[model samples]
Target chain A: MTSPARQLRGKDERAPVALSDRAMDNLRFIRETMERSASFTHVSGIGGVAMGLVAVAAAWAASRTTSDGAWLSIWLGAAGASFALSAFLMGRKSRAEGVALLSGPGRRFAWSMTPALAAGGVLTAALARGGHFGLLPGTWLLLYGASIVTGGSHSVRPVPVMGMAFMLAGVAALASPPAWGDAYMAAAFGGLHVVFGLLIWRKHGG
Target chain B: MAASSGAVRRRSLEPAERAPGNLDAVHGRTQESGPLELDQLIHERVRLGIVSALAVNGSLTFTDLRDLLGTTDGNLSAHARRLEDAGYVACKKSFDGRTPRTEYGLTEVGKRALNAYLDHMEAIIDATRE
Candidate 1:
């Protein structure tokens, strides 16, 4: 059995390990709560840059095409490539950050963004079939922006702002002459992506 | 007959004696009564951090928890083991290709305990303010 003096000394030794005051504990609790509930922080800046480059390339390729069919095909191909690149880069970044690909925030972002993308796909096919190709750029930008804004609500702050920018570009593309469609696409997708991607990269780290 | 009667009396009296202690245990403060009995297991900073993180993420790998909690491998392992032993957390071992990976998630008991702990702390804060 321990002596009373030894027990008293033991208690004294252990005193420092005790929980901190109420304020500190509350602060810690609040912080942990936020960390748990917040969206995944692994949105890939490099992925955005890659997507931007691909958009620039697609714009260049589409501009060289004389027929509407060829232009549509080129842009569609670019879309597929962008999707693949984004998935690959996001996967890499998520792994590096130890965030699951299907984490709560990730799932939320996908769910919110997927509908807009799906709508864009349907609208693209319909617009192309109807020979309303001039409106295609504006439609794509608007829908893509909508998706981003909706989805980015669940992502980091800049994402939604980028989405809003895309939406505005879509409106301008619609107001401009049909001849300016591809230029608008190039500007919004290529320019905005590179700019925002750089910002996210610099501010949020890789 | 007398001996059996005394045993029954003690058994009946046990709960009455234990009732106030239980209240003290839940409140985790004893200035007005006896001593507070906070769950010492989770009161420690590192252990609480680990548990709190797990409570939110649903599951986390050993490396994930280590990075999140900023703890060394050995320290995390020891605390995780203690929580595991208490049935407050569950651990699963698997392989990612050739590499072995260990993942942890809070068990039901842990979730309930964490909720109770939070509520108790809030109560303490409320009482102190009052």
Candidate 2:
């Protein structure tokens, strides 16, 4: 389904110019901005607790099985480290800064990264065992983006646009069949993440 | 223009949206060009916060309102004046020996305005449901 966040933006502009003076426009802008901020940042990011759980599970999974592939174990360790560190930084930012970390751009990034990271880990394992590594990363991105957009929009987050855009590119990549799935996954997770994270930091710095 | 006229050297910041129904129509015309309207009374954010909080809490002291909304003394005092002017809330100031104290609660009029606002919200939801 089309997202509510997109609908809100379109619905806003469709209102007649004759409705009120420029003053009305200004008020609407302020109110909508506030509402969207509250939805994306304050309400939607309540999943930091779940992210904490993922960190624990990754650490435990890495510990329990010595026969697991060494590289796979390392990847799981990195996932655990990154998730714990992100959650820690976010938690500190939320409490100290009074602006919740799990909300807004941070939350959006976390949501997008989760499925991509998971699929990447799985695909890396499967590819090492001799299989076509074409559709995994793209599928991960497409699904992750669509999920974030769907979940975030109900609460009025604007960050889902970023997710949707990345997902669309992922769709194109998969349809055209990229030469390497790992490269595509790296682009979606590492490159796209660094870029969007920097953008968010610039716009709303810690 | 009127909300920030000479009497109150404010930043020309007109607060947006009152109780969202007939109350808004009354405030719109009056705030534009007429005597100060009662609908304009609790529209300011701080005052509205005070009212909404009190509506939930029954009563709040001056310090309580200040702590809840994080407004400075002078900032809250100015907005409280508007509410008081319209008799939306009854503010009582007192002194126990040396320290100062103040308590505020919704007046009959304030209760009615809050009720009207809730009713307006219910009507909108009901209409959407239909």
Candidate 3:
């Protein structure tokens, strides 16, 4: 049986380019592949780790009872695992540079999101601790959106605009407390992350 | 796998006609001009590493090249052997201590070959640029 790597390398060697065609078509494919490779796990990891940490924190902040911590622990583990799996897969792709690195910019591009995610997390933690139940969720959404937009890859469509929208919504929530603050937060950060992360992750497998 | 250092040594007996760095590639192209020079060489990553490392530094120890190239001992040795057969690089063994070690280098011919390969790439880019 032929080795899978051998087959892939052979295909890579044989993959045609139009010698006379002055075509940079392969450049887009390379960039898209690289962008998807870097963004999926990194974005997922951020969302996953953030979700896990917040769930546990929120649960503790909500109840005086230990049961809340236990409940929170479940979410932390689930999200953490998803983050880890994505991270591992992304690492594997890095070894094949012709296939991945030449394609996209990198995960560090996603790392630029620190200001937004951190700002959101800190605000949420403070709100939860202070018993300001209404603001905690809104803060998370705003921050999540802001971070994703700031740190997200250029290759992905609509990430920056969506992030801007979330920041705007967050400002609105703070200006006037609303009944749907939590939902908005989830929509901005958690929902957007899960949605985009899943889209990128699915592309990796297929 | 064939240790045909003799072929490479004999080829290098003719004093190299190319300029040291940039035009070495151009002169190399004129010599081969067709598809025959690198026919046996596959231009794989590890081999690229060996060729690249040799091009920059005229010689390297097997351990040094292994470290620079980031490959397992067997993997480095295998790729080095292929390049050696193609007359693109040369490796020789010596004692580092009680243990044995190997050293490799790009011969003048190998340097000419790498220059030729790079010239080909630059030509492609130059063609696209215009």
Top-scoring candidate (lDDT): 1
lDDT tens per residue, model 1, B13-126: 133224112324222344476544446576566677777888766678898778777889999999999999999999999999999999999899988877766765654444
lDDT-best of 1 and 3: 1
TM-scores (chain A) of the candidates: 0.82, 0.48, 0.47
User: Per-residue alpha-carbon lDDT of model 3 for A31-74, expressed as tens digits?
Assistant: 33323333332233334334434544433433443343443344
In candidate 2, what are the lDDT values of residues A86-123, reduced to their tens digit?
Answer: 56655765676566566554466456556655665666
In angstroms and one decimal each, the interface RMSD of every candidate reads 12.2, 12.4, 14.2
- Of candidates 3 and 2, the better by lDDT: 2
lDDT of 1 by residue, A1-206 (tens): 86686477543332221222342464466466446545565678888898999999999999888999999999999999998998888888889877787777787888999999999999998999899999999999999999999989777778999999999999999999999988998999999999999888887755
Judging by TM-score, tell me the better candidate of 1 and 3.
1
Model 1: fraction of native contacts? 0.02
Q: What is the DockQ of each candidate?
A: 0.03, 0.03, 0.02
Q: What would the C-alpha RMSD of candidate 3 be, to one decimal place?
A: 18.1
Which structure among the candidates has the greatest TM-score? 1
Write out the backbone clash pairs for model 3: A30-A103, A31-A103, A34-A104, A141-A185
lDDT of 2 by residue, B1-101 (tens): 22222222122222335322132222123345533223445445676677776664445688877866788999988888778788888998989689899
Q: Candidate 1, which segments miss by more than 4 Å at Cα? A: A1-36, B1-130
Docking model 3 quality class: incorrect
